[model samples]
Target: MTWLITGGAGYIGAHVARAMTGAGERVVALDDLSTGVPERLPDEIPLITGSTMDADLVKQVFAEHGVTGVVHLAARKQVAESVAQPTRYYRENVGGLATLLEGACEAGIERFVFSSSAAVYGNPDVDLITEDTPCAPVNPYGETKLAGEWLVRAAGQAHGMATVCLRYFNVAGAAAPLLSDTGVFNIVPMVFDRLTRNEAPRIFGDDYPTPDGTCVRDYIHVADLAEAHLAAARRLTRGGAAGDLTVNIGRGEGVSVRELITVIGEVTGDGRAPVVEERRSGDAPRAVASAARAAEVLGWRARRGVREMVESAWQGWQLHHGK
Candidate 1:
């Protein structure tokens, strides 16, 4: 079955596309190239340039490619930007999702995998967040993701589509240097950017109520996250009853920010101490995933560790930045 991967040229999307294709799944990519690099995708996979907001394009791709399933990853994602432009986030993330769902339902596509975020849980006080954790997004970006999940589930129930929402934790590392994330919005790349500039990596806050007095997060290698998507897609394709499944894609391990910086230092050989700063608004003290649901549902677990993530991400940073 041919699957349509929206934002297939992006960092995460490209990884997902590659993982799916490597598993011998027929796939096509749709990306707007806003922040996505076309070269990240392989030469063989067909890459369509358009917006999910375009209903005609969505319908055309679905019909022409005979797409039986969809891995929807195309959306605006940036906490600061989303906060600055809430309307744009709603329009692009939520509105685009609505349009795609409409087209998928019309086209009779039964399988869908949505790219969700751990941000939907906001700063929950839980030590290990589960799928059942209450969602209280602190920013518009998270709000959009949560709303997107709702739309996907509602559409699935109404249209008899088997759907999975994979709520991602901190995604780092790469399958390869070329497939590495080019954006610095994430912590790994952000730290890499600072180190390359000979600047001390800035820690947002160091007085959180954690063991190290810093925020703790669960980091998963991008490749593992991609593989999780494949597992979800395959489960849907196996012809189970139409239903909704939401699971966290994480390592089920917590790494404090300070600990991560130390790992980066060890990997990059730059031991410049990080500068502690005021806590960023809405910063969660700790947000680790239980990962039990994913293991039970998808039979998947992260294979790589934090050191591997930093090492792989550092390689990508050097490849792109020539550091």
Candidate 2:
């Protein structure tokens, strides 16, 4: 009963891989090294160097390892980048899933997990977004993710592929150093990186409708989010029915951008604040998860506070960069 985690050597994928392996599950990771690093995974787990978009490679990995389940995490994730390059997002995020689904459905891999994004909600009229929210995505990145989920759903109907889609917001922190550098990727670490160098973190907007006049979002610790994935995997392993199980993996509360800078200051013991800038395109006024369904259905809720999330991230940053 082996499981395959695509993009397992990357940020959140590495954390999920560590948690699953710690629970004594036999796990294998497949990554193309485009954004993944080998050092992020534990020594015992096997990593295949290939893209999930490759039909032959996907089938070969499934057959070679006798995989029972899959956690698909590999995708082009930047919302701004997607806006710039819509075609690449479609090909990799949509086309790749299409190819992988063909192989998984054929190989009888029933249990499947997908790493979706809150971008699917795309600045909903409601302050908080629930699973039932109308998914009117704003960017190509979100569109592709929604499309990927649809493909997986089709597979669930055609074959008995029990699917779970975790709609993610800000997935950050590093429990283990999978990459050599922390600040090279992600918005959270990028801000932290600026602070470490005594530079002002960029606050894209500060005149929003929220309390702090900044964009508000629910940022979940990657560790807590990873556990939710494992629980979904367990449900699938229990011969769960073939249907779509969509859950938002975030705490119910929202944090403003300015508040985040203040929190980072508190966590790092620095009084430095962020530098205000013009609003970044595609940013919403407020984005938070209504995680009731996740807690009720998957028995999962994010327990870590904003402080812990920042502290763990600080610890990871210090560990990686010695600051």
Candidate 3:
């Protein structure tokens, strides 16, 4: 079955596309190229450069590619940007999903896999988060993801489509240097940026209730995260589950900001200390995941550790920056 991968030129999307294609799956990449690098995709893969908001274009791609399944990863994902520009986030993320669903349903696509985020949980007070956690998103980005999940499920049920929503935590690392995450918004890249500049990395807060007084997060390698997408796609293809399957993709361990910085120093041999800054508003102290459901449902588990994340990401960073 040919699958339409929205945002397939992006970092995570590129990895997913590479894995899917390597597995002998028929893949078509649909990216707007706003932040996506076309070179990240293979030479043979056909990439349709456009926006998912354009319903006509989306439908046309579906028909032209003979797409029977879809993996929707196109959306504005920056938390800060979404916080500042809620309207744009809502329009692009939520509106884009609605338009794509319309196209998928119209094309009678049998399978759909949505790229969701752990941001939907906001600041869960639990030690280990599960799929059943109450979704009270604190920011516009999270709100859009949660809302998008609803849209995917509803559309799938209405149209009799198999669907899966993969909720990702802090994603880091790369399968290859060329495929490393290029954005500085994430903490891993942020730390790498500071080290490369010979400047001290700044921690957002140090007065939280955690043992280290810093935010604790679950980090999953981008390679592992991409593999999870492939697994979810296979499940959809097999039609093992009748309804929607929502699962968290993570390493199930909490790494404090302090600890993460220390690991980065070790990985890069830049033992410079980090500067503690004031806590950013809406920062969650801890948001570790319980990956049991993902393992049970998709038979997928993250294989890389934080150190691997740092080293692999460092290789890409050095390559990209000539460092």
- Estimated TM-score for each candidate: 0.99, 0.95, 0.98
1-323 per-residue lDDT for model 3 (tens digits): 99899999999999999999998899999999999999899898999999999999999999988999999999999988998999999999999999999999999999999999999998989999999999999999999999999999999899999999999999999999999888898998898888888899999999999999999999999999989999999988888554799999999999999999999999889989999999998988999999999999899999999999999999999988755
Residue pair clashes in candidate 2? 40-178
Q: State each model's C-alpha RMSD to the native.
A: 0.8, 1.7, 0.9
Q: What is the lDDT of candidate 2?
A: 0.85
- Candidate achieving the largest lDDT: 1
Query: Could you give candidate 2's per-residue lDDT for residues 147-215 as a string of tens digits?
Result: 988888888878978899989978766555433335456666887788778788888888988888998
Better of 1 and 2 by TM-score: 1
What is the lDDT of every predicted structure here? 0.94, 0.85, 0.94
RMSD of 2: 1.7
The whole-model C-alpha lDDT of candidate 1 against the native structure comes to 0.94
Q: What is the lDDT of residue 284 in candidate 1?
A: 87
User: Ranking by lDDT, best first?
Assistant: 1, 3, 2
Residue by residue across 1-323, what tens digits does model 1's lDDT show? 99999999999999999999999999999999998899988898999999999999999999999999999999999999999999999999999999999999999999999999999999888889999999999999999999999999999999999999999999999989988888889899999999899999999988889898999999999999999999999988886653799999999999999999999999999989999999988898989999999988888999999999999988888999877
Quote the positional error of residue 106 for candidate 1 in Å. 0.6
Worst 10 residues of 2 by lDDT: 174-183
